[model samples]
Target: MSKKNEVSFFDGKGLRNDGRRLDELRPIELEVGVLDNASGSALIRQGGNRILVGVFGPREIHPKHLALPNRATLRCRYHMAPFSVEDRKHPAPSRRETEISKVIREALEPVVFTEYYPRTTIDVYIEVLEANGGTRCSGITAASLALADAGVPMRDLVVACASGKVGGKIVLDLNDFEDKYGEADMPVAILPHLDRVLLLQMDGNLTPKEFHEALDLAIEGSKRIYEMQKKALRDSYPIPDEPQEEEVVEVEK
Candidate 1:
């Protein structure tokens, strides 16, 4: 995009654009309960990019054909702001966004205990206020956290992260510039407790072995993110394991 864009990951001393090591993510900041009306919501800011997500329903299925008697349905919508990019993105769901939304829904379906609510629906809406790169991963990350905040039952929370090849080396969490010039990208979603992947996608080019290595790097990064998620949720809602208030005795005649 920019002529000043430099190939990251092997910059002689091996430092990335934001001074992170190859396997480090660009610092992520997450906030829940940001939206007033949504049933569940969260916002994620990874470096300069900003993504806000709102999850509604487990309520009902629309259009009728989309409904299933056996299990609930999961729906996702991802969009970018007009000024989110340097080139200015349109306020519509591009073809890429459509495909990504489907994948994201599939990713969370496994983590969500959908069978608990049969013949229902869950809607996850993600809006990217800024796009420096890796918005899809950020959206997924924010959506998962929002779902939990909404009091949805789930087997485990999903943490999404990405890794890619830059200057012939697998770099964890590609920033804006590296993604444009880098060789390949692999984004993944991990179930924290099980430590297993739920969503995986790769683009561009890489050897099969390199792909595996990249995946490992992404998983490592996701775990770090998972820790952050847990801390954030706890900080927002802290409860004592045991009751703190003393019970009042009642004297009746």
Candidate 2:
């Protein structure tokens, strides 16, 4: 590795390149109801990543053979635009995209009340407008919000976060540079209200102790994000204030 790459992840003060503490996440912003055409849509920006998710259906599933007998089948597509990264990605879906799509579908399936809409399909589309790292986790986060915005009944919202080891220490929400050169990266998703783990995937190696630490950190980060997700949904529907009673209207009449 070049000298710059060697010391690129951390400094003598034990802070990451972006000046975040070991357990600190990148700044996150989330919004819902962004796409007018979709039944439900959401967007999330975390660090340098930008992801949009749109949810459509509990609509009839064409190719009837694919329909579930007793529950709605969930389909997810995760795609990155050609300009999403430094090197333009191919427009065609890659093996990685295929795998992440499946991962996101599974991660969300548990929370959805598919039984209520049997013989239908719930389609989730995740588009990565930009990527800096941890796109899978970010995609899951936004996709769940889109599902809620679409008015899909669910047990609870799903939230996700990632943790990894860099420069001999674990860190929360690894950016692209740390993820590329760090020792390990683990992304986790969960149903926050039910306290259920929906998805956990790790890339790279970590000791048993380090793995536990990373998992705990990621979970904490996810819970924090869960609060933000709730706020975004709440903001979309502002409760109208009650109208004030007119005073002395009888005198005017």
lDDT of each: 0.85, 0.93
Candidate 1 Cα outliers beyond 4 Å, as residue runs: 1-12, 238-253
Expressed as tens digits, the lDDT of each residue in 1-253 for candidate 1 is 4642543345557678678888888989999878888988999999878999999978888887888888888889888888888887777789988998888888898888888777888899999899988988888889998999988898878899999998788899888888877888888888978877888888789898998899888998998998888777766686754334322222221
C-alpha lDDT of candidate 2 relative to the true structure: 0.93
Q: Model 2, 253: alpha-carbon shift in Å?
A: 12
TM-score of each: 0.88, 0.93
Q: Which window of 10 residues has the lowest lDDT sum in candidate 1?
A: 244-253
Worst 10 residues of 2 by lDDT: 242-251
Tens digits of lDDT, candidate 2, 181-252: 888999999888788899999999899999999999999999999999999999999876544234455556
lDDT of 1: 0.85
